[model samples]
Structures are given as structure tokens and as C-alpha cells.
Target: MTEATNDTTSPVRPLRDALTFLLIVSATFGLQLLTLVTGIIMARLLGVEGRGVIALVLAVSVFAAQLSFGGCLPPAITKLLAERGANARDGLGHVFRRRGWLLLLPCLVAGGLMLVLLDDGAAGQRFEIAVIAVVVTLQTLFFSIIGGAMQGEGRLVRMAWVALTPQGLFTIALAVVAALDWGWSATDVLLAYIATGVLSVLVAMASLLPAERGDDVGAERRVPEASLWSEARGNYVSGVRPLDGLGLERILVGGLLGTTALGLFATGLAVSNLCRLVSNAVSVVVLPRVAAHQGDPAQQRAVVRRWFTISLVLVGGIVAVLELLVEPVIRLAFGEEFVGAVSVARWLIVADGLLALRRVLIAALQGQGRGGVASWVELALLPVLVVGIALSALRESLDGVGMSLAAVGLLSCLALGRAVFRAPSARHRGRATSCTQQRRW
Candidate 1:
């Protein structure tokens, strides 16, 4: 029999794929730009030291969110949804319910952690930081899960717009606060941040309801919860590897070097990380499609080659431009107070470019249910990151921290490259050539 018929066969598939990629890239850029603007607004309004407080708060909240189901489930959900014979509605609903209860653990843990860490703030201010961290964690979880579902369902165009919800809402709130010239403190800005999260969750949830109901009518058979969790556990590690660097680095910077240093480092990270737009979008678009076509090794190889090549070219251009323009851009956009971020931003830009390729390689492996391979690779690299950051701190050099991060990215790309691109063994080739029966994921 001929292979299954799908959108891949359409005559306009190239154009359509190009448009979808653009949409995803645009949305990702919007998200990054908004985050940069948010930091700028805080810096301009609150000064460097005040921005430091907000930085510490966000570092804690995001770290906690990464630890929870929000950060862990997206890749897993996307892969599950992309299974050709799987029930998107039933599978999504099943996994959502199974994992929703655990959200509380992150909320409570993050809040308590933040409360204990805030030694300098007034008791009321500390309480607010803790409470807001809890709220942000939950909201971020909803955003991520819904976004992942949308991607896995192959609604890439719609997913792009939905991805902008939280940041869009926050940008608007920040604008209002700034325009009104309210004497807003760090707490006020954070209050505004949490308010947007609430609105974003409502909007994202409401937007998905119609699709969920429509999916109800044509739902296929459900995958067992046990199987889903088995996949999720491997992907959870794969997903959190990036976050481990992100969450812990920020906490360590704040703890060892102080919040002012964190503010500079965080802002640099936000600016430099805009380079990830291409790779981030590529990973999101590539993973589900690869998963859907998992039985075909040739198709998998071709898809990875095309998308990963595109990711590299685009990211290379972005890193070069950012490297040239970042110093000026930081001064012009974020002001002189954040000029210290320039050194940090420059090195981070290189690191981000390396990370761009690493992510695509990881996505390819994850789509094949071989996420454990990449997870082990990252686990081995984790200590290198810790020691590097510690050395950076000891030297009191942000540039040192940036170099350490870049080293990790370079090593990860080299390691994962070997894994993803190596020639298939005789056994693997035989399995690929002989397999004709449809296997359940």
C-alpha cells in the first residue's frame, strides 16, 4: 500500500510551511521583544537596584515553574498529540487531568522558597513576592500546556498567536502603568505582572475551548495514561535540562554575586536569547511532524537536515548582528544603568547560537522516543556548567559567566551532533527497511 496521505503531499506545502515558520518566528520574536521591553520599563522606572528586586522575584518564579509540570510536559504532550493514530482530544484531556493536581506542589514550594530568600524586603513586600511567585507559576503552567497542545494538534498558525497572550497582556499593563506615571515600585510592577497572567490564562483557556469541543466529535482511541507518563518522564528530563541551567544560574548569580548582578545577567539573557527565536520555532514545528512520521528514517533524516540547516543559517546571522549591535542597543534601549549587561550580552549571544543547533538535535531525538539519549548527554554536561558558573562568580566577572555558558552550549552541540547525525547501524537499517507493520506509540 502507498504511504498515508496527509498535508505533506499538498502542492503548496512549501509555501504553507514557510508561512507557518514565519508565523512562529514572528510570535517568538514578539514574546522576546516584549520581555526585553518589560525589563526596560522596570529599569527606567525603578533604576538598576530596583530592577534587581524584580529580577530576583522572576528568577525564583521561573525556576519554580520549570520544576513543575508546566516546563516538563510540553514536549511530551506535543509528541503524544502528533501520534498519527492517537486521540488528540482524549489524550490531551487525560494527561491534563492527570498532571493538573501536581501544579500545587510547585506553587507552594516556589512561594515558600521566595519568602525565605527575601531577607532585605519589608515583611509585606516579601509576602507579596511569595504570593505573586505562586500565581505566576500556575499561570505559566496553563500557558505552556495549552500552547503545547496547540502545537501538537498541528494548529501552528493559531498556536503562534496564542503563544503571545501572556506577554501581550503584560506589555499592555506595563504601558498603562508607565503612561499614567504611577509612582510604581517593584511590588506594583509585579502586581501588574501577575494580573496579566490571570488574564492570559483566561484568554488562552477560552481560545482552546472551541477546538477542544470540536475535537470531541472525531476523537480516536486514547493512549493509556501509563504509556503517556512513561513518555513524559523521559521528555521531562529532556525538557528540564535547559531550565536547569536557566533556573539555577539565576539563583546562583543572585545568591553569590547579588541581585544587581542578577539584574544585569538576566537582562543580558533576555536580549541575547532573542536569537533563539529561529531554533525555538524550528523545534516546535519539527518535533510533532517528526513524531508523526517516526516509522520513516529517511523522512526523519531529511526533515532534520532541512530544518536544522535553516535554523543554523538564521541563527548565525542573528548572533552576528546582535554581537555587533547589542552594546549600542543595550545603552539606547535600556539606558546606561544596564550598560554593565553589554559584556554579558555579547558572550550570551554566541552561546544562544550554539544552543539553537543543540535544541533541534534534541528535538529530533525526542520525537523518536529516544529523549533519554539526549538527557544522559546533558546530565554529563551539567557539572561542567556548575563549576564554570562557580568560577565565574569567584572571579566576579559577568563575562566569565557568559563564557562558561558558551562552553556548555558548544560541548552540547558537539555531543548531540554526534548522536543525531551518526550513521545507522546494520540492525537499525534492517529494522528501518523491513518494518511494514504499524506500531503503536
Candidate 2:
């Protein structure tokens, strides 16, 4: 969202909520640091071309999962879970029973395609990549559900453990793989990722287990989340969830400008995504909290404003640092072959900051289970993204892609800004959401 009004008389935020945000931010730091290290190692090992190849593969994997599967289930479940109370168990069970099998196809498709792409490399490589991709994708889904459970339940510290454990495992896996002298090809790296995913899933499951309730009481988040938003939760099959991959920019980039450009662009992506760690940490912790207090539009706007303020404050410093150090960072992290990413990286960090801000507002809307007027405005710009990114890709200009991103980011801020500040009463969204839920049933 845009800059919030400086309302000195805004109510004081709860110390507990502030603390939760800090803990998640701390965990996000650890997670992203681990990821940064992993990316650097992988980039060094894979070289520019191979790194780009993996990026294209990533784009494909994301496309297959988000587009085909309709990416809104987990967060919807999260909001619903908080509001479900006595129905939590039944609601969750119904979700998995009905949709669990649907999850397998997308993961399989992603892994199968990656396997096919690697057919000419090595038989073992193909097998390993396919297996790891499928496993990782599966783990991703499980991780989302478990993490969302924590989010809705407002177990921020526990959620932090779940989020951070995988990264720790990843670092360990990389060390083991390197010690074992498995050359860091895409297959080898992905294999390590799979191992981390398995371990992380175990950690998440453990954290969520009933036995841990005693220990978590110290964090003031021990209660069950079923009662958080009992009255205002959305239908299970709500509107299209804010799945980042649903955007077709990267796939189109790979298709039009070729994989080499994809590689260069992915380099920038690696750097730019670092900015999301902050904003997502905010969104992840804030969504359930806001959703828990859904009815008061004034309180909601105040919460959005707080988040918007945090976004500007954090992003300004992050972008400045990244801009100043872009070249040296790229050179040291991914080497000279990816020097082209420096310019793109600078632009992307800005785009990503705005995107992250937009994400917070989207999470705010989702917390209420129904989007406001601005959500549709953002959706209507989906065509703008397609056309902009496509035209940019066609011109073989990474700069164009960055510019397109900035334009989209600006529009998203305006749209989501309007949403948070000018949201309609719950009545206005009732009919549309009911119709969709009815159709889904």
C-alpha cells in the first residue's frame, strides 16, 4: 500500500503483536541468510547458464503448481481455521480429503517436466531431479498448510521454527553434499533441497504436535486458534488467492527472450527476492491478527497503515543498501558472468519492495476472506502485466522487464492502497463471494 497518514492518535498496538512481528522478522532473517548462502553456492557451482536453466525450471514449476491447482486454498484454510473454532478439525479434514489428491498431479507434472528437460544430461540426474522436485513440491504444500496453521493460530515463534528449520537443514545438506564431493549441478542442489524439505516437514509436524503445547505457553501463543475469527471468516472456496506464481511474467520471459535471458533475469530475481523476507514476515504475522479483528474497518485501516509505514521505513534502507552494493554483491556472490544483474537487481529491489507492500494489503483483504473494490482493479491489470512483460521480453531488453515491473508495482500500490483505506462494508462483498462459494460447492 501507499504511505499511511501519520495519525498520532492511532491506538497503541499490542506489545504481544509487536513482539510476534519481531520474532518472525528474526526468523526471516535467518531463513533468507541461509537462502542467500545457498544461492551463492549454487550460482558459483552452476555458472550463469546452468543457474539460468534452473531459474527457467523454477518458473515452470511455479506455473504448473499455481495455475493448474488454483493457489488460494492454504491461506483460505488459514483464515477459516482461525474462525472455525469447533469446526476446525472437520473443516481441515474435509479440505485435505477433497483436495489432497489434486495436489499430487501438479507436483508430478513439475517434476516430470524437469525430468524430461534433463533427459540428455544424465540418467541419474534426471531421476534425482524428478524425485527431488516431486518431494520438494510435496513438502512445499505440507509446509504451507502447517505454517498457515501456525499463522492462523498466532503461534509466531513456532511458525518461525518451522520456517527456519528448513533453511538450517539446507545449509547442512549443502555442506554434506559438498563434503561427499557431489558436484553442485542443478540435480545435486535440488537433491539437497529435497533433503532439507523432508527435515523441515518433520520439524513443522513436531512443532504442531499436541505434546508441544506446554512449552509454547511461555510465548503467550499457546491457545488453539479455532476461536480467533469465528464470525467473519470467508467461505473455504474464496476468490483467487494471492499466489505469486499466478503472474505469467517469468514464464513469458523464458519463452520469448530465451533461457539465457532467463538466466540473467533469474540472477536479478535471486537478489531481488531478498527484499521480500521483510515484507512477508510482516504479512505472515499480521494477517491472522488482523483477520481476528475483522469487523472494524477503522481498526483494519489502522493496521494497514502501520504495515504501510513499516514497509516504507524498512524498504528505504534495504533498497539503498542494495543499490549501493549491487555490483560488489553480485560479483562476490555470483561472479562476473552475472554482472548484468546489477542494473536489473537495482530495479527489481524497488519493484519487489512495492510488491511486498502490496502483498501486505492483499493479506489484509484475505484476512477478511473477501477482497474490496481494489482487488478487482489489481486483477484487471493482470493483462497489463502480460502485455508489458511480453513486449519487454520480445524486445530482448531486461531493462524493459524491470520497467514493466515498476509500472505494475505502482498500479498494485494504488489499487491495494485504495483497498485498505477505502474498503467497503462487509455487505458489499457478500453477494459475489456467496455466488463463488456456491459454485464451488
Candidate 3:
């Protein structure tokens, strides 16, 4: 199949496909903008210390949410859901029925661990942070699963809504508080954030029900439950384990260095994340497209190479511009209080650019059923990250922490690139050889 191949599960034309990609990019951009605004409001209202608390809570929640997946169910299931005529409802239900309860335990453990280990002399607020972490975990899981379903069905617009709604709602709440000059504390901001998460989940869930009303009429004919889990487990092996560590970085920074440093790092990281706007959208859109060409090794490589180039060129340019403007942007938009974030943001921008490349490569590898290659590379480098951060913190240098992240990102990008561009599998090569002989015959 070519890049524009139309099937029941993917777009039919270049124009429609382009529109789908643009919609996702626009939504992602909007979500990031809202997030930046929320950060600005939080920094202005809560100052550095309060913002640090918020950062820690969010980091813990995200870490726990992704951890509970054991590193593969989301992508694996989403890929299965993309099979033409697969019953989306059955696919979603089967996994939830088997593994749904597994999600809560990680959240509880992460929250409890954070509460026990990190006490910044604010026992009351610390308890609140623990509670918020659990709530945020549930919110993130629901959003991700529902969004994955949307993605699986090629419902790109609905998927984008799932991505945007929570941030949008939370940003509006913060705006109201800012305009009215309400005496909202850090705890109150978290409460509002969780509330929006709940609402967004409800909205996303409702969207699926109506759209899939008859999608499961012949559920037995769809992909089998056993097969789905089997592939999910395969994906699980590919490990993407780096995320487990990345998620824990905030908790580590908070416990080892204190919230003030975390706040500075979080602010800088947030600003640098804007550089990922195009790459993020590209990563999301590339998965199924690459998967669609899985039967043809050459086609799969072409797809991966084409999108990889696009993501690198576009994201590279954005990183360049942001590097020049990040300091002023942080100073003016986030206030002079966050000036400490400038160096953090600069390092993170370089890391984010490298990360943009890594994401596309990882997605392509996953699509090609070679996720194990990427997974092992990431798993090996996981230590480099943990040790780097610890040594950096021992010296009391947040810039060193950021540099460590950039270093890992660069290494992962290069390693994954080599893996992605390596010779096709033996099976594919043999198939090609057979085809050539037959044609000669």
C-alpha cells in the first residue's frame, strides 16, 4: 500500500489524510497553549513553591498512570483496534475486563510512596498532594485509553478532543480565578484540575458510545481477545521502559533537591515542550500509516523515512526559534520569578528536539512489530538517566540534570535510527527472493 492507501481503517485520500493530521496538530498546539497559560497562572498565583508542589503531584500521577500499563497495552491494543472491521467495543471491553483493576494499584503505591518520602514541612499540603496524585492518575488513564480508542478507529478529530478538553477546562477555571482574584491555594488549583479531568473523561466516554453503537454487531468476527492480549504482551516486552524513569524524575527531583528546583525545572520543561508541537502530531499520525505497510518492508521503511524527515526538519526549526526566544518568553509570560528556568528550558529544548526524532523512530519501530529493538535500547539507557540526575543533583546543578536528559535523548535517537534503518528481516528478504524467482519463471 502506498502512503495514500485508503482502507476501512485509514483515510482514503491525501487531502483527507492531510486534514486529519492538521486537526491533530492544531488540537495539540491548543492543548500546549492552554497548558502554558495554566502554568503562567499557577506561577503567578502560587509562586515558585506552590508551583513546585503542583509539578510534583502531576509528575507522580503521570508516572503512575503509564507504569500501570506495564509498558505496552495502550499501543498494542490501539494497533489491534485498527484492524479493519474489528469490533472496537469488544476490543476495548476485553482488555478492561481483564486488566482494569490493575490500574488502581500503581496509582495508590505511587501516591503513598510520595506521601511517605517527601515531606516539605507542609504535612497538610503533602496529604493533599497524595490525594490529588491518585485522582490525576485515574484521570490520565481514562483520557489515554479513550484517546487510544479514538486513534484506533481513525477518529482523529474525536481523539484530538479527548486530548484537548481537560487542559481546556482547567485553563478556563484558572482564568476565572485570575480574573476574579480568588484566593485559591495550591490545593484548590489541584482540585480544579482533577475536576476537569473527570469531566473530560465523561465526555470522551460518551463520544465512543454513540459512535460505536453498531460497530460490534458481529463481534466474533473481529480480532480475538486472546490474540489481542498476545500482541499486547509482545509490545510489553519492547519495554519503552524509559518512560517509567522519565515519569519518576519529578518525584526524584522533589525528594532529593526540593520543590523549588522542581518548579524551575518543570517550568523550563514546559516551555521547551512547545518545540514538540509538530513532532508530537507526526508521531501520533505515523503509527497506523506505517502499520498499514507492514507487509512490505520497503514500503514500511519509506513511510518511516518520509515522516522522520518531516518531523526532524520542522521540529529542528522550532527548536532554533525557541532557543532564541525562550528566555524572554519565560520572563515576560511567566514572570521574572521563573527566570531560573531559562537555562533549564534551553537544555530541555535540545533534548526535546532529539526526543522528537526518537518518538518518530519509536512509533515506526512499533508499527513494524520491531518494538523490542527500541525497547531494549531505552531500557539500557534508563540507568544513564537515573545516575545522571542523581550525580547532577549532588552537585546542586539543575542544568546538569537537564544536560543528562539531553544526552540520553541524543543517544537514544542515534541508536533507534540505526535499528530502524537496518536491513529488512530475513523473512521479508526471503519473500522478496521468492518473488523475484517467480517473476523470472
Candidate 4:
């Protein structure tokens, strides 16, 4: 029997990993449910207008964070770990210590600029929104770095706890505070988010401390500096490439359709975000598996295909359900003023399904170390998105506008799917060629 078969038959390792994956998924889903309840409470307590304001601020914060972080966290961490699993334990500490300051510099400058440029009135009573954004960005960077360390070591259970607890607790706390009328203004809400972010970082840091004391048992050899730079750049490019077009498209929509229309659009996006809980759960499991098997072509392809199929089926089913119950869901979550949001949500159910497919395809690319190609694909689609959003916003009817925007999502899915299918088959071919070359050598 093969060595791998013998190892598999040993029983302990697979069981442990499977149990860990199950635990992480269960805890994550629980947290997601709590978060959903929190959102519902916030909508009920704040009313449509208030919730709209909160949504606007959040959108801006998330946009700023993406730009500041360069959207590099996931692939960077996963790649680094996969490439230098053991050495990563040592090198990452140095990388974080030195790079932390450099990363924070851009975020600080951007946050300051945003504070100066955005109308203070838009921030409303959440005047401290800018500060909260800064804090959240810093915390996110630190958390990502630490989480990367845990992932690199394959300690996913620890990583999940470090990554999710603060978010779960913060959502629960905010809902409770808001419900009780316990000094919960918009600013207070922002503060809670910032606080949660800080706590997450702290927990992640704590998780990493033990690794410092333990031996680097599985650390891979250090990658070359040039290779490391190339990988990092490629990953950053790939991750943010989609944002270039997508961000511009949103901007165009807001400018052409006005804030009220944007607000309505935002609600649809938020409803769609609920669907992501499933995608995230799957990703949390799939990503590290892909990374660990980077050398195995057949396994990699099989995993990618399986994940894509499963994600599409699951997301599609959820969207269908949401489509059927759109009106009642809106009434229960956001009250009557947001009745329009129901139709928007129904349309977005389709959009989010498309988005989930795109996400899974991109994850596969990242796993295969083709982040640069993925980035290019996103860049290619930007203009189409921008133009689509602009045209949609110009429509006279609000419902027409929503439909137009949703169409852009459908278009994106088609374009992205084509690109993913067409990606270089070189990785698979290389495996065969390498075996022949090794025999000759």
C-alpha cells in the first residue's frame, strides 16, 4: 500500500481534522445567526432612515478599509503559510513587526483625508466614525497577520475563535445596548465595532504567543526574497483588481441616482450579505485545504470543482427561498418604510448567487497561486461594471434602476465564469512534465 494510504488508515489525524472543521463551522454559523439577529434589531430600533445612515457610514468604512489594506490579507497569509509553513512561524513575526508600521501609514493618511473630505453631516451623530474607521483598519491588519500565522500552522480552530469571537460578541452587545436604550447612539455603535476589532486583534495575538515558544515543526524553508515579492504583489493585484471596476460602478450609481437611491441599493446589498455566511463557512474550510495540497494537481482540481458545485447549489437554494419570502422578510426586518427594499432584496438574491460563484472561482485561483491572473480578470471587467451601473442609475423608475444594477451582477458572473474556465491549464500540465524531467535528470 502507498504511504498516504497507510497514513490515512492510521485514523487519528483525519478524525481530529474533521472534528476541528466541524467545530469551526458550527461556531461560525452560530455567530452568523447572532449577527443576523443583531442587524434585525438595529433596523427595527433605528427605522429605515436611521438604518440608512448607519449603512452609508459602514459602506464608506469598508471601502476605505479595502483600499487601505490593499485587500491582501487572505491570499498573502495563505500563500506565505503554504510556501513556508514552518519558517513562517519565525519570518512572519519579523515581517509583521517591520511591516506593521508601513501598512498603517497608508490607512492613517487615507482615513485623515476621508475625515476632511466627507461631509461631516453625512456622518451625523457618528462624528467619530473616522476614528472608528482608523481603529478598525489597524485592528483588521493585525488580526489578519496573526490569523495568517495560525492558518499557516494549520491550527484552524484557534484561528476561527480569534477571528470570530469579537465580531460575535460585539454584535450581541450592540443589539442589547440599543434595545435597552443604554446610551446607544450611532457614535456608540461605531465605538462598539472599533472595540470589537481591538478585542479580535488581542485574541489573535494571544493565540500566536504559544507558537513563539513552540518548535517550528512544520515550517517550510524560506522562499527567495524575489519570489516572495512577486507573490505578494501578484496577490495584492489579484485581490483588489475587482474593486477597481466594482468600486467605480458603485460610485457612478451613487452620483447618478442620488443618495436615496444608493440607500435603497445598499439595503439590497445588505440582504445579499446574509448569503455570504454560507460562502464564508465553506471558504474557511476550503482555502487551507487547497493551500496544503498545492503540489497535487488532481486533488486541487477536484477540490475546486467540488467547492464550486456545492457553493452554487447552496447559494442558489438560499436565493430561491429569499425570493419567495421577500416581502414578509422586509416587513419583519426593516418595517413598512422599507417596503421598497423587499423588491430590491428579491433581485439581489440573484445577484448574490452570482457573487458567490465568482468568489468561489477566485478562491480557487488564489489557492492555485495564480493571483496575478485573477487580478487581471477583475481589471478587465471594471469598465463593463462602471458603465452598467451608470446606465442603470440613469433609469427614471426606481425599480428599473434596481433591475439594471442587478443585471450588472448577472453580467459579472458570466464574464468571471468564462475567465475562470479559461485560466491556464499549465499547472496541471506542468505536473506531468516535471515527472518526465526528473527521470531524465
lDDT of 3 by residue, 1-441 (tens): 212235625445556667777887888889888898999999999998889888888877777766666355666665666654343565567557776887788778768966975555447677767877887887787777777666666576777767788899999999999999998988899999988888888888877733245655566535576776786677664533563334666777887888889889889977888656777678666766775555577787898888888887888888899999999999998899899989978998998888778888887887666777888888788889889989989999899988988899999989999988886678855654564344221
Misplaced by over 4 Å in model 2 are 1-13, 68-70, 84-99, 112-132, 176-182, 211-247, 285-296, 367-374, 423-441
Name the runs in model 3 displaced over 4 angstroms.
1-5, 8-12, 94-99, 211-216, 219-225, 237-246, 428-441
Best by lDDT: 3
lDDT of 4 by residue, 1-441 (tens): 101111322558456445665676666667666655666766666554445545545555455555545465544665555544443546455455555577667556545744653443455533366566566666655665566566666666667666667768687777678667774555667677777767767777666634445454433444444554565665665555454312443444444554455556656565655455666556655554554455565676677778678787878788888787777866777577677777766766776676666666666665565555566666666666666556665664445545654565566567655654554577654653464345221
Clashing pairs in 1: none
As a TM-score, model 3 comes out at 0.89
Instruction: List the candidates' TM-scores in order.
Output: 0.88, 0.79, 0.89, 0.79
Q: Which wins on lDDT, candidate 2 or candidate 3?
A: 3
Worst 10 residues of 1 by lDDT: 1-10
lDDT of each: 0.75, 0.64, 0.76, 0.58
Residue 103 shift from truth in candidate 2, angstroms: 1.9
Q: Say what the RMSD of model 2 is.
A: 7.0
lDDT of 1: 0.75
Candidate 1 local lDDT, 127-171, one digit each (tens): 778888888777767777787766666666677787788788888
